[model samples]
Target: MARIVDVNPALVRQRAGAASEFLQVAEERLEFIRAESGESAEAQVAASNAIAAGISAADAICGKALGRRANDGDHRGAVELLDSVKPGGSKLALRLSKLLSDKSQLQYGGYCSAAVARSLAREARKLVEAMNEFGIRS
Candidate 1:
């Protein structure tokens, strides 16, 4: 069984700050995608990376507030951890799950369209917002 440990308040604040920073970068990348009219692997990869960065920001927030870090190798583990923090099958959990599912295809192999990339960016924004709210709640 995994146990909840003590997280330093200073660390929590630091993590939250980092999350905010990442969210900003993710938003900027999303904007860049919006400015581009056509689809490209580079755009897809950027969108995917932005989503991953958003996830990382959320993970940092959850770790600080919940005192449990997600397993590095398992994206699902990160989702589970976020769920633990938010509970009740929250939208945040659902969005994270979807984004994680899309992440691999966007990053590695598969066809990623402009629409898909845009959708991922929107989801990433939502997740980042949720993380920000969670930080406030904590």
Candidate 2:
């Protein structure tokens, strides 16, 4: 059984800041796919993965901040992390939970669409920005 660890506020804040940076970069890549490409299927898939990675990383940091261990298993891990964070609510967490759940569906089952990927990325950006608002600092 995995256990949640109580982390220092300063460390949590630092982790949140790091997660925000990574997520920002991921969002940028997703946008680059839009600006550099014509929203191709490959671009959409790439964007989806990028955002997923960003969310995964972001959730991991937030989870740690909130006294949870965001592990692997994608969506399941995300949900567990959210639960660890008290009431478990955040736009980024919600969006990520959804996307992480269907990532295999998008990648293997070909459900990834340019519009959907872009939307997910946008949501993730908002979440990361929100984390910054929560006193995350370098």
RMSD per candidate (Å) reads 3.7, 4.3
Alpha-carbon lDDT, every model = 0.63, 0.55
- Candidates in order, TM-scores: namely 0.71, 0.60
Model 2 CA deviation exceeding 4 Å by range? 1-18, 31-42, 53-61, 83-92, 107-111
lDDT by residue for model 1 (16-82), tens: 5655565566556555554456676646765666577556656666765677666554677667677
TM-score of model 1 vs. true structure: 0.71
| Residue pair clashes in candidate 2 | none
True lDDT of residue 63, candidate 2: 48
